[model samples]
Target: MSTLNFRRNTNNFVSGSYDKLIIIWQVYSNNQWYCQQKLNGHSNWILCLLLNNNDDLIISESEDNTIKFWIKQNQWVCQQTITYHTGIVFSLSLNDQQSKVISFSDDYQILLDRKWNVIQKIKVDKYGLRLCFINDNQFIFQSFCQEQMQIYEMDNKTKQYRRMNEITIKCGSNFDHYSFPQQYVKSKCLLVNKNGKSVNLMRKKENGDFIIEKSIEFDDQRIYGQLGQDREYLITWDNKSKEIQIRKCKER
Candidate 1:
């Protein structure tokens, strides 16, 4: 599987694979999981997937340079396909209000509204492996192999987004892998970012500044993990260790 998203308030989850398939799985009361649906639409490897707050909508990006919207009717179906990107869509992020979406690709960073219409398209100097929305009007983008992550904010007057600042991060080498992703915890004001061989943990302050609290280094570049919903643990698996490790959040 390339990417997966668990639906909130439900025992179901969705996964996208490099084989160009999206599978929805449901857990039974007996604790066994079964495939509920298989969505076939993308022509290339699926890179990212996002489930909305209600779990009725799904946003997916692929190496075919297309972004697809799968909506739930009587069953899950592809309601729309966006072909605006010229390169592989690497990542997808939904804002807190679920009103906007941002996608990062090799070519451009495109923003779309709830209606799935293009709001803004930004061409960055360096293409990134991941980008995420911290809030409704703000987002962070990490350029490939760079030690700095760029911040963008929406202008209240023009209602357009512009690059506001950059946060320095740890990148031990020029090499990195795809799909580790950047995750932000709103409740804890925390960000878990994977760049090169390190996972940089940062705290976002109310003043819009970020403080790097810790950077967990690994011997290998392929690290995969997710933060627990309760903001108490981080579970990770890396090629170097070949084991699933869980780390508890410590109060500082």
Candidate 2:
């Protein structure tokens, strides 16, 4: 799987593949996941996908620089193509209302828009390290260098984005865009950023600032770690699948 995502209010999820197909899976009464729909259109590996608020639209980006919009009528079909991207698109992120979006591409530009119409664009040194909206008017942006993670807010005066604050991730040059995974603790307004060897928990303050609350390290540097949905457990595992373990988050 290249990328996968779940839709809220339903036991359904979508998985993207290097084989250039997007499969929608649903859990039945038997509690077994079964493929319900296979969407095919993108001619290259799918990098990311986003399901909108109503779950009626799915936007997918590909390495071929193609962004396809899939909508469910009586059946799934390609609704339209987002034709402006000229480079390999790496990530697709929607705003809080699912009305606006921002994307990172190999073209080294951050493009912002609503309903496929380009609203504003910001040039950067690199693309697709980790770009996400922290709220409706604010987002976090990182470059390919990954030296710093900057927070950007949409300025009301200019009606465009402006850098508000920054945090030094300082992961160094060896790690690339996909080196870290971030999980949001919505209830606590915290974001868990997990690198190979360390996990950093960032709390978003009322003033639109993010501060690191804690940083924990693990012995096995390449371990994959995830915090539980209810913030009760922290799960970790190395390459050895059998060694996977779960422990209370408080014990970390």
Instruction: Summarize candidate 1's per-residue lDDT along 118-215 as a digit string, tens digits.
Output: 87888788867988889988899988879999999989999888999998999897888885889998989999999999899999988889999999
Positional deviation of 153 in candidate 2, in angstroms? Answer: 1.3
Each candidate structure's TM-score, on Cα atoms with residue i matched to residue i, is 0.96, 0.83
Worst lDDT run of 10 residues, candidate 1, spans 106-115
lDDT of 2 by residue, 161-219 (tens): 98777786534234443423455665678777654345666788887667777766555
The candidate scoring highest on lDDT is 1
Q: Which regions of candidate 2 deviate over 4 angstroms? A: 170-173, 177-186, 194-198, 216-252
TM-score of 2: 0.83
Candidate 2: Cα lDDT at 2: 69
Pull out the clashing pairs in model 1.
none
